[model samples]
Target: MSDVASQAGRVIDAGAIRAGTSNAPGKTAWRIAWGVALVVFVMLWLFGKPVAGWAFDVPRAWRIPVQRWISDAMKWLVDDASFGLFSFTDLTRFLATLVEVPYRLVLGLLSTGIMDGRGSSAQEILPPLSWLAVIGVVALMGYFAGGRRLAFIVGGCFVFLAVFGQWDSAMVTLASILIAVPIGVVGGLLLGLAAFRWRAVDIALRPLLDLMQTVPVFAYLVPILFLFGFGPTSAIVATIVYALPPMTRISLLALKGVPDEVHELGRMTGCSRRQMTWRILVPSAMPGLMIGVNQVIMLSLNMVIIASMIGAGGLGFDVLAALRRLDIGAGFEAGLAIVALAIALDRLSQAFAARRPEHVAAGAGEKNLLARHPYTVAGLALIVAGGLAGLVAAPLQSYPEALQISTGTLGSDLVSWININFFDQLEAVKNALLLNVLIPVKRFLTSLPWVGVTGLLALAGLRLGGWRLALLVSVLSCLIAFTGQWEKAMITVYLCGISVVIASLVGIPIGVLAAGRERLWKFVELVVDTLQTLPSFVYLMPAVMLFRVGDFTAMIAVVAYAVAPAIRYTAYGLRRVDPQLVEAGVVAGATPWQLLTKIRLKLALPEILLGVNQTVMLALSMLVITALVGTRDLGQEVYIALTKADTGRGLVAGLSVAFIAIIADRLISAGANRIRARLGLPEGEGGHR
Candidate 1:
């Protein structure tokens, strides 16, 4: 009581509260166990045949007849004449028809023909001028949007694409993105506002939106392809689904963050709710909304390659084509072009968001000069100059044949050579992994009766979260079983599990090492940025080359991509640990390992848990993507649905994957929240609000 009580009574000393380098009694044993577990996981994962087989073999087949019966019933209802007025099919068809007219008009212009009903001119409708004219105009727009710096960057990116002989494809991708982004922004804004204003709508939408956010992109593509058919129409629909979440979240946040006094003032000015929302709320939320737009554009761009699968012709299609034929260089170039586009859009949107609204007097010189905004004037001049120069300068409009850079047949040859050279080595590992790890795991999961699996999950919930989370997990899991895709869903969960475990194994240590020095953190950040920016498809070529096609290749690709976030979060968590803790460890004659394990890591658990959560989400997202290498899971189901235009199957399968994600999300989040509460971290007040 004398010394301890005195210390406690004095000013609540921060240093005393700080952690130090005192190892827990079983720390060594725990570390050794972790090390052994990791080795066994990797070895059994990479080399053993039965282990892989267990991961994939199905002990129980889902009775999909119920789903098939439902599909048949739905099909019959749509075709039955007596149900016309109330038929959801009829309503969907009507909506499709409404959108078709504009879609056709745009498509017709891009095509080599005109719609006869419009009675347009027979002459080939040029885009008002040569390619040079378009470039000049866009460069001007870029300059106006930012400055000469942005103009140069934007113009340069476009010119590079053109000179690389990918001019047409680049424009196609750009056009779709330009259209999709606005639609996403508008749709997200409306939905978000509705959710914010109406408690009932909020309650109803929260789960649906959660479903949408977690659902695999490939799953939704089937419905979109069926409803809209292939081409830009399908692309736009999928893009909207993909990009809408961020906008919804950001808009809600901005609206909720608006000052109470400001909102009251608007009401006092006799503004109605609509006016308050449109004029006051939206304006106040501009910066946040612009950020949402930025996210929308980025996400839309990310989807472009996938959208290509359904014939939304663009750089995405080219990448896919190159991949199909194993043309690495062409794929790499196209991937780089995508990266360039992303960077340009991100910078431009950030500028827009950061720009402040001006407050000016009527007589101000700045106000007068606004008409001649420097960037605008400069842009206009460039447009004129470029167009005029193009009229005489042939090179601006067309690439010289002699100078055309070509990856040529070498790309294909490289792929073929690698496949031929390493097939034996690859096959052995693949066979072993498939038989040992993938198949056996799949069998074990499928072997569990639905009731048994649900019971275990509930027990886990009780341990890690609480009764509420246990109940939520149990209900969601049962939903998947009832949907008749339980086995496939389990496979997806297994793959995600494998990928996350591997990623954490690799990512956490790197993060720990990186966190030890400021310079290392900076370097790790740069690497993470590059990985994030590069298209996932780009990595596929290398993965196939090194590991060949199968679960291993898929694992490698996803692990590489998913590891970035883990490293980032770990470094961040470790760096954020109290400095006094480290000093205390040093003063107490503790070793580095003791300091990290007993002091820093214990304190950093909350943040690291969040990182693990993100890692799981990212890994699950790769499930469909990795299916390109061939795997039997919900992702494979979505892939099949896309090819067959099976909307019912795709949507259901996608929903199953989403349910799995939601269960994981709820469990991890509840656990994290509980831990944070105990550790005195700030609590999240659910959703954006």
Candidate 2:
């Protein structure tokens, strides 16, 4: 009887242990949080009509008058504000003039001849650099930067620009980028340095940096347009604003990452604070800082198209014109020019960033400059020879129109053929997607009570992170609601959400396949890299050509533009999975499918989630550009405000979009972190296995 009782007690103890292990405290908490949220959501859906009326949408009476207040403040600034001795307009005009000086100089050097007078009386003093000379110099720089391969790529891109009749516009765009990039880099570096030196400044700058980056590019133009008035100056200012944040953030990080040993070395040398920062810290951090420069360059080029709307005329203006007229051929040609320029500059900058200086023996610096830098001398010689030859040959001075090739006719013919033969099929596919997948999802999302959605998202934040994340999520969500942008915000979410889902669906499988095959991954890597280099505006052209302007067209563009990150992140994550774990599974006699499903996929889940988070960010950014193709969401609001020069309205709408992006970014990131923790991974090991 005693033995039987002891056996029963042991069985009960075993059951208790099993229960504790299966339902750990954290797991139980998660279950309770989710269960409560589900019940609340159901109850809200069923019997909360009275609350839903107010909660579904914030009434105008309850909405904040933020727009009016901002508008009034802006008006006051423009009309009456002064900086002691100078009025606001005075300062703005002076700043504009400062920007215009370098811009005009670069524009003259590249695209237009220097002018001696104003208007019709203006006389050309010197012709712009010969197209051949420009190309040769750029090619030489490429050769010096990377080698023959990079030289060919850079030279080929420029030659294409000239041969394809996009030389003038491309140069104009290039000029803007050249000017804006330097300013952005300098200003960002200074700001970063300041922030790094002062902890309080770093803290203060964090949220501002977040807003500067997350806010749609279009939102930038409104205030600049209002303040500086419209022209290339305003556009340059906007580009600077758009490109500055990344450089600043990168610089700060780079400075922080400099080794303590470097600091100690500087101090041992009796270096002053300034000398230590410039000579020791900055040089030690140069590689990371160059990454910031690369970002600034890329971002400056990306802004070219959007900045054109405010009068930074170049390839951007050409593309915008073609887009507006629905001229597919012209748009494609101009878009390709932008791509060519982007790829060339991207490669050149990346090469320079990765380049290391060769060490010189003692007194090697005494060599003549011409002998020491053969590439530079050769580049200069080519430019001089080309310039002198241009004095005799008109063709050398400017590319001949007759020699230029255009694909406009070919593009038109292709479009015509497709429309004539396959229009019905295309329409069928588009309609089926809209009717079956898009419209229903949009309607359901739009129908959800704003309060309920906010609560659910907040609850998600709570489960994934903690109360702090939950509070942040709810506040940002409420900001949209109280701003009277709840409906439009929901529409934006619907579009972005659907686009993300589609991108993930398409990108993940390809990424998975690519991960296991080296050749396939190389091909996928090349494709994604090329796709990423194209500006956001370029994606719209193909989408519009295939599916005219509407929500469908917008979704297609957003998906194409946003899908690259998903593929990249997934492949990267899968590649980072522990090979030993795979070996162990194989040793256990697991089949290929079982190894992938139960081992690789499980371990890579956190990384895949991060990829999705990146996908969400890219989707939101592209969705703003989709506004050009007639989607009515927050992007449209910003667009309308831009047209009207309504600073407050544009800012309000743009901030709402930023809020949405932030909430999504934070929540998703937290979820990924949670998964990492559960997997027993160390924090901040996102880049490692």
Task: Report lDDT per candidate.
Answer: 0.73, 0.87
Query: Over the stretch 382-441, how does candidate 1's per-residue lDDT look in tens digits?
Result: 556654665677665454656656666666577678778988887787778778987797
Cα TM-score per model: 0.82, 0.94
* Overall local distance difference test of candidate 1: 0.73
Global local distance difference test of model 2: 0.87
Q: Which candidate leads the pack in lDDT?
A: 2
RMSD of each: 6.9, 5.4
Evaluated at residue 388, the lDDT of candidate 2 is 95
Look at candidate 2 and give me any clashing residue pairs. Answer: none
Q: Provide the clashing-pair count of each candidate structure.
A: 25, 0
